[model samples]
Target: MPRSPYMHLPPAARSRTVTAVLGPTNTGKTHLAIERMLAHKSGLIGLPLRLLAREVYGRIEERAGTDAVALITGEEKIIPKAPRYWVSTVEAMPLDLETDFVAIDEVQLAGDLDRGHVFTDRLLNLRGQSETLLLGAATVRPLLEKLLPGLNVVTRPRMSVLTYAGSKKVSRLPPRSAIVAFSADEVYGIAELIRRQRGGAAVVLGSLSPRTRNAQVELFQNGDVEHLVATDAIGMGLNLDVDHVAFAGNRKYDGYQYRQLTAAEMGQIAGRAGRHTRDGTFGVTGRVDPLDDELVEQIENHHFNSLKVLQWRNSRLDFASSASLRASLDVVPREDGLARAPIGDDINALEHLLRDSGISTMAKGPKAVELLWDVCQVPDYRKIAPANHAELLSTIYTHLMQDGAIADDWFTRQLAFADRADGDIDTLANRIAHIRTWTYVANRPDWLADPAHWQGVTRGIEDKLSDALHDRLTKRFVDRRTSVLMRRLRENAMLEAEITSSGDVLVEGQHIGNLLGFRFAPDAAAEGPDGKTVRAAAQKALATEIE
Candidate 1:
């Protein structure tokens, strides 16, 4: 029978319930998914990253109307009640809800080490027989097809290789080009160079918060800044239209440690060029360096390792009782050089850390015990949770006090370490002082009588729980081992410097994508003791570039 015009399904999806759309960067995979979604009456769009999820939510709301869209992520939720259109991180999606259509963004990440399993399970486990659209990079298509043979597959590559009108051997970038570096320190250095080389154009880096990053993106979007110095964080969301992207650093640190980029990573950065049709000229420029050569080789060779499994468990909210996992944690292994020391064979104090920290909310009973044994024996174990803030701090303090790992006298010598370690009198102190104000208000019976105070108390507990989470997840609550591991992962990649069509030089590297957008203003000059402007001319010279 001929389908009725009132039918809500896309013509392609009408026959089959599942559809997979795959492509590399710049192939408009996401745009296609959005179009398909528009054809349906209602749908759910799931993104991997919080930033991308938020960006998609904003874009969807702008097009579909505010009442139609809502956003949810691990840290934030904008949806007060159920809305027809939902945008959320895949992990944050409610398991109970039923929707007509589901769009899974970045479906390629299903092969990722940390959260690929989430995608796999979610795709495999979706209960509702709704039409599904899977969007991801080209490399991910085969994997998805293999996993779900019932789905239809569509593949697209980059329309054309980018080219530029400028000379090939150009030493410097042009006025309106951007140089992308991988690290915060290098980004700042490159910004300084832009000031020195390009008549002091203000450069924007990627380390700034989302609000600040958006502001920086506007400067580039509005043509307020001619050149931007930034990191990979700028690559995905802002969509700054630019003529060229130059690699500042050639390498980047992966989550666990520094590593060279594979073909997929390099393509992502290079693909950022010429996103807008108006900027027809597009190019990727990189300097020759050991790191750069390695990245090139990886891309050319298409060398990449199979995805590794990353096991992460929530110690706070997942399990009902913390006391259950305590006994098992008591017999785990300690120290780095130890071999497969089984809990049944060798007993160590380190194994007891989870128990001592009051975080027994792990895998239930026997499985929890089994996992603990594996964690102790396995060399790659990275612990994620341990309990409440007080338990965590108290455990660390107790251990440190007994072992004297951190010198006690250092706390007394405040002036010596004040520069290295932020002092009580610094910005954190001001924040802490506000607690006293709240305490005084709480002491008043009249203030306590108000319902607002009760809510405030609830908020305080949530804040404490959040802080506990931050400390544990960030390795702040744990010892130096976890912190060192995190640092190693962060420093894996390096940056390579290159020149763009605009006669501007930039640093670039693997994993560091194009500057989607940027915004920054030149610092204004300050007055000197003699009443003469100190660095006033420098500031004015810098601001002039923006104008």
Candidate 2:
């Protein structure tokens, strides 16, 4: 038998009481982990998504107070003096931080092709001083046990029933439903249809800035929108008041290829439907075919095939030189059920930079090589192309190595390009992505000459862009007059009406038409169902006022 890669686990770490809280979504596993972390004097928790990390940070802050909690993600960092609790994205979690308790959500992601290596590394190497909790689906149980001996495993039942409601059209999905799609184009298309048919839908995509995503979610949660159009981003523990999940498309491009979602992946997203003790349903919509009976049974039962192997990468890098660094990263794992991950964005960026003779010469020593590796980790948020992203990375690396830090003027110029708030929805979203790249740069310690000042400047710009993007999305996909009237009608609330002296009729502060004597004329633009909706609402309100 081959020796284990985790043989380096210290005696203390090996002895810590590590618990695996395995369950489907809405089983309150995250809630339990948070409670456990708060019980300790100091603790750290790593979540799968920056959005989830932000959500958890807010919850922890509300309980532990702002001064005691710190939030760290690639693009955002908020650390307070003498912080007792730390919340971070899995990629951003500081493994060196010594805490009494440590918890990692979505442990099953260790099998993910792209990001699994990081999760696998955390699973094996990161341990709390006293207690550690691994929270994820029950499918991870077999793998967790094989990896960690003497692991305490607890399974929780779903709090509510998950049923298969079969297929439904986008226009027919229930209120408070979330229509899940795999691509931005699909999401936008569905949202547009819902706006035409069901008033509007809040949009949530992995690409949206956390601020914008949250604002969009608010539109649904607060009843401004009757439905939500989102990608599988909602799968990563976003607690929403959703009663059903309609899959507009099941297949997704998982970094490498467009493939059907595994039963586990489907369960994760479908599981987002119900919250707490409320029941939920899942089904197909749009152009996708209906799920097979067996697959539907598996999802409804929350049963999934156990992960056979986990993606692993050599975290202990040589960094002596670029060549040594690449060699070390390619090292195979000795442990069973562990496979080397394919080249990721960071490694690709490194290879691209190494191709440049100037960069190769500068990245000579261990310090320089390590800095190069760190620079490679900057994510390609813009997604323009690999070459374009590599060019940006090269510029940043050259600036960092030539000067002690990136030149303020150059950084400011890059930021200035994305600072403008004028753009259509796609344009604004693109600008938000551009600003996010600079935000990540600003968050990197020592990357900028004045990290604190740049952090503030970049964050302000991101917030501004996020707000602009949100407004653009709402304007493009939402009809506020229709949504307000429909919601009011649903609630059986009496509508307010006013008539101007010039005979203009208004309902709920929205101009419906002109009242000429006994005739109520709707606006020329109101046609189809919209015209009927306006007439119905107008008649209800005017009956009380005109009489």
Best by TM-score: 2
TM per prediction:
0.56, 0.97
Q: What is the lDDT of candidate 2?
A: 0.90
Q: After aligning candidate 1 to the native by TM-score, how far in Å is the CA of 256 from where it should be?
A: 1.5
Instruction: Report the Cα lDDT for candidate 1.
Output: 0.46
Q: Write the per-residue lDDT of candidate 2 for residues 121-174, one digit (tens) a residue.
A: 888888777888999999888888887877789999999999999988888888
Measured over all alpha carbons after superposition, the RMSD of each candidate to the real structure, in angstroms, is: 15.9, 3.0
The weakest ten consecutive residues by lDDT in model 1 span: 526-535
lDDT of each: 0.46, 0.90
Q: Give the distance in Å from residue 295's predicted Cα in candidate 1 to where it truly belongs.
A: 8.0
For residue 435, what is the lDDT in candidate 1?
31
Model 2 ranges off by over 4 Å: 1-15
